[model samples]
Target: MSAEIWTGVRERVLALAESPGVEKVFGFPYGGTPLEDPLTEEELADLERYCGVRLPDEYRDFLLHVGAGGAGPTYGVFPVRRDADGAWQWHGDGGDMTLPKRLAEPFRQHVNPEELDALLADQPDEEAYEDIDDYDTANDAWEERLFATLWSDDHTVGAICLCHLGCAQRQWLVVSGPERGRMWDDARCDYVDLEPLGVTFAQWYLNWLTEAEKTAGTVSPSETR
Candidate 1:
């Protein structure tokens, strides 16, 4: 999509933030409608280079024309910024989960529910151990193995954590492989397999915007399609 697609999106979001009862939105209070400055071409290039993956087209354009992040779905999109040391990093709650180095790798496209169930079932139980120390050791090992099997960086390759939905749940935007450009739900923290949201980055953001506007009474029902 052209940069024009993002034109006025920032203003539209600002409008939503100011609309009546915007605070009633689930994450509006925490986000407070803060919007970062849009990235320049140089900054966008640097981000893509550092991440080793080109962002989804819609997201890339949003970064260029709208804002790098801020005032988005849930608690708002995680913002990427250059630190004092001039290294680009995404900053927000759960933002560290987005491993920049792993963006080049292809994202795992499939999840086996039975295998996940089996893994959860195999969790070490303290009562099964004869001694507390044994239980601690065994539990640690099991936890490590569990993370390696399902929650490792390898499992989330080519995806970036975009927003958190309270608790430990977060949303990811796939940046590589066949699923590139789609959003995925990360419920592995709850021992659930990842699932697609069946929406592209733009669609996801726009849907949230429409809902937010409606909640704020800024959009009439007839205006939405």
Candidate 2:
């Protein structure tokens, strides 16, 4: 990608992170680890040639901005989980990694701009769902309750729905709340339009790191590093 395009992508991502509805921005490592499995220039060229499709502008910018693994804070980004053993692993600072579609499932669920707008319009109290487990919640109980109280008159705007495709490593995000149904008898649509990228599984793991950062409440990588 051109330097100008890369710069534009970085600026856009940062701007999105600053948006009122956006809670955080996530970067997944593509290729591999920098120090452990760094991507050689020749290898990158070969892979690009093999793929035929140049990576998206924003995604390419992400690679340059974050480098190959270990470039940013471990938190906020999801870490790669080994399918064989379910153990977590981090990509080194430089490596030949690819972003996998499975890893991006979570973020794509709320990709629909309209749905996202609705979610933001009726944003739930962050405190209410603090205890909800990201991996084991049986239902959207906390979210539903909060939506009921917050948007009692209109539920369609506050409904929450699960992503059908799942997130990185089959993780899920709150795309809609329950109030939209009880109040408006309206069927909620929380799905987004973004397509998932097919890259290395390690990219999916980057999400775990992003979650960790959110827990720590630090912005810059240095704060979490």
Candidate 3:
């Protein structure tokens, strides 16, 4: 990937905040603040040391040169901060999928995006069966499994939820394991399942910046592809 990608992302990211219907609750009156300044080298080191893993360089550069946390894709990027006890942390989804765990452990890549739709596409519609109880027993097992794993932290074991895209969709950036720097869409809650976008941190961030421009008038929707 071109190293200059982050610079282009910065320009496009500013345009994103102006898009309509984006509920930016942080960094102003009422919500917890978002970071504005670039993180210092020492600060980055402190963060990595606390997390027990080094962040992807592109992501680190984005955090150091572009912006720390506030003002990013959809609901905005998760902020990195230190807690009251002085433990460095990533402030997002306090579930088991998140912090205070072993980060070097490889993340399990379970679902392939291409097969995701087909996996549930065959699910029988409720009205297909005359008896609801019959459908519940025979037709609903796979659907039930989908829901079970949807909320399971194991699905996104080594990734952090970066931003929520509404309608039960969210973007996650891997921090450790085999996909240490890739991004994915976690839509398991809605049965869409996990889909890897095959983009790195810089490209993923660029994806949103570009999408925001397409949404706004500054750039045409077709230009993004």
Query: Which runs in model 1 stand beyond 4 Å of their true positions?
Result: 29-33, 110-112, 220-225
RMSD of 1: 2.8
Candidate models: Cα lDDT each: 0.81, 0.32, 0.65
Model 2: worst 10 consecutive residues (lDDT sum):
178-187
Off by over 4 Å in 3: 1-4, 8-35, 92-97, 111-148, 214-225
* Residue 187 Cα positional deviation in candidate 3, in Å, after optimal superposition: 0.5
- State the lDDT of candidate 2 residue by residue for 83-133, as single tens digits: 344322223221112232222122212234564557556544545565657
TM-score of 2: 0.25
Which of the predicted structures, 1 or 2, would earn the higher TM-score when compared with the native?
1
Q: What would the per-residue lDDT of candidate 1 be over residues 2-60, giving only the tens digit for each residue? A: 56657678877766677776776654535344577899999999888888788888999
Ranking by TM-score: 1, 3, 2
Instruction: Name the lDDT value of residue 143 in candidate 1.
Output: 86
- Candidate 2 global CA lDDT score: 0.32
Q: Arrange candidates by lDDT, descending.
A: 1, 3, 2
